[model samples]
Target: MGLTHEFFLLRSESDDEPVEQVVLSDNLVLYIWDSFRWIPAFNPSTKENHVGLNYHGITLIRHEGANLLKDICLSWSSLFSLAPSTLQLTGDFVMDENGNGRYEKLNFTRDDLTKPLTTLAAIADRAFLENYIIVHHGI
Candidate 1:
């Protein structure tokens, strides 16, 4: 099976509240491999970097509506170091009865001139996560 990433939105700091979850693209594995370098290898046999252990945190807005999802996308784009002008967000989403949300499709585009390969790759990672959560979680 391919590597898969999961994203979750916690309703509160306490674990009692339900959580929102989604499955992200496996392409994130490749992006992480290309973007970061591992270090201090004792031997070639055991030198592979583990992509599954990597994690990144992004803050979400506290608003109670679709704007929360938009804020998440914007925040994720910023985390990837994407310039505002280069990042474009377009999509539709819906929230379920249980307060879970998913995107019908969240599309993001960036101007090549304004982004480097690493940034572009990271953007893909962020976009995939954002889209996956929006589609599966109902946001």
Candidate 2:
């Protein structure tokens, strides 16, 4: 009924196609939107512009981006005292400076952000440790 993100984890290190998929909550998608570059999940439908599908798509996160995200998440972990319980999720996903964010209130924790963050990190770590091609999917 609403837009959400899907994180596809590659089942094999040698495989580019993902066998498992995760649909992230819409609110978490918005809260963590700023952490990602958006290009990770490349969808042709939104070549010019789109939100749901884009946020709803699973993009790739290169090592650099993943590293940055890891660092950011670390900072967030340090910054927030409640671990994840205090991580307020405001569903204003359509990030517009002019105040166009919809579904703007929820006490949801970082469960949404945590999953992607871990997934992205795993992708990066595995690529590095296993010595494989790490082309990111568009997140």
Best by lDDT: 2
Name model 2 segments beyond 4 Å from true: 11-23, 38-58, 77-87, 93-103, 110-116, 131-139
lDDT against true structure, model 1: 0.35
Per-residue CA lDDT of model 2 for 1-139, tens digit only, reads 3555555445343576764444555555556556654323333444432212244333444333434544654454344435656455455545568867666566645554565555645554554444332333233
Residue 98, candidate 1: C-alpha displacement in angstroms = 53
In model 2, state the lDDT of residue 33: 59
What's the TM for model 1? 0.25
Taken over the whole model, the C-alpha lDDT of each candidate is 0.35, 0.47
- Can you give the TM-score per candidate against the true fold? 0.25, 0.50
List, residue by residue over 1-139, the lDDT tens digit for candidate 1: 3444444444432333334444443443333333322211111133442322233422222222223333433444456554454443333467889999876442334432223333333433443454321111111
